[model samples]
Target: MRLFIAIELPDGLKRAFAGLRTPIPGARWVPPEQIHLTLAFLGEVEETAVGHLHDELSRIRIPSFKLRPAGTGCFPGRQRARVLWVGLEPEPHLRDLAAAVQSVLLACGIPQEERPFSPHITLARLKLPAPREVGLFLSGEPKHAFPLVPVREFILFQSRLSSAGAQHVPLHSFPLT
Candidate 1:
């Protein structure tokens, strides 16, 4: 199955992000339901590996912690941006949880990710024919600062790619306790 681990955002935050979806042209906005901060992307794992992954993840114990979305930015350089995201505030618990997840995935014989973990909420994915007006829109975008919310659980999500956008379904949930 096509799977990944992530922390889902509450509706309030989702709506807040959805509000900013406009103005940026040629960018595919993420559906509110699929707005989540991914911890790891485990592409196309075997059905049998699911059980092993679950068992390993079940041992990860992290206390609930607050996360606040900070400034906006684009990945892979601003000029050649592929993804736009809201940066995350530095939270110790978040780092710990990420490290623990990485360790668990490694113990399950999953290949280590070469890129360092940088937490952020993906807002949109840009297409090649990005609108010329995008530079002005993104430049004048207003700042956003919202109340921090506690994340109590992380989920394993299955992604089914279709002609439209991808559909994310929560396959399993691991609580932070």
Candidate 2:
């Protein structure tokens, strides 16, 4: 089964995310319901090991915190962009939470992600040669600041891939207290 751990956004806030979408050729916009800040992406895992993953994750006890979308940018490099995203304000506690989650995954014998954690909400998937405006779009600050939202919990999501796009389903939830 394909799995990942992430902080899902509230319904109203997700609608606000949808409001930011713009028409860009070859760019695929993510549905508002699928918008989330991923903490860890555990590619594909055996069905039997999922139980251990859940057990270890439940032990995590971090205080809930808030986050806000700050600006827009593209992944890899704007010169060769593939994924467009909205950056979040720097929050030490958010980083701590991600680290704790990663630590547990490692203890559970799951291999660590090669890339360091950089939290952001992906807005679109771009196909190269990406439109020239992708770089231009990210050049300035966002016209307005998105409201702050609480992060009371995170969920272990199962990603179902299909011809259309990936659909995420929450399998288990871990609360912060």
Candidate 3:
């Protein structure tokens, strides 16, 4: 199954992001319910290995922490942007939690992501490279200051791909103290 580990956003944050959706041509905004901060993207794995993955995840122990949606940016640089995302404030605890999870998953035989962990909530994907106006939009300082989001748990999610985009299913949840 195609899997990933992520932190679910609170309803209030989702509602706030929903209002930020603008009419950017060729950009497909993510549905609020589907918004999440991915810690690791574990591509397809054998179904039989799921139990082992879950076991490793259950061992994670970290204190709950607060995060705020800080700014907006894009992937592969703005010049060739394909994804637009909302950045999260850099919290050491957040990085440590992600590192712990990735470490365990690697020990479970999952391939490690070469890219460094970047904490962000994807807002949309552009069919083509982002336009000049999109760049301008990201250039401005974030007008909205999202409330501190208390992250108490991270989830192991199963992603099912379809013509309608990907549907994420929470297979298991591991809580932080």
The Cα local distance difference test for each model comes to: 0.84, 0.88, 0.89
- Tell me which residue pairs clash in candidate 3: none
Q: Backbone clashes in each candidate structure, one number apiece? A: 0, 0, 0
- Tens-digit per-residue lDDT, 1-177, candidate 2: 999999999898788778777767788889998999999999899999999999999999899999988998889887778898888999888998999999999998888889999999998888874657785677644575788989999999999999988899999999998
TM-score of 1: 0.92
The root-mean-square deviation over C-alpha atoms between each candidate and the true structure, in angstroms, is 1.8, 1.4, 1.3
Cα shift from native, residue 163, model 3 (Å): 2.3
Candidate 1 residue lDDT tens string, 130-176 = 44444553664556677797899999999999998799989899999
Better structure of 1 and 2 per lDDT:
2
* Off by more than 4 A, model 2: none
Residue pairs in collision within model 2: none
Q: Give the true-structure RMSD of model 2.
A: 1.4
Candidate 3's C-alpha runs over 4 A off are none
Give per-residue CA lDDT, model 3, range 12-94, as digits (tens).
Answer: 79888877777677888999999999999999989999999999889888999999889888897887788888898889889
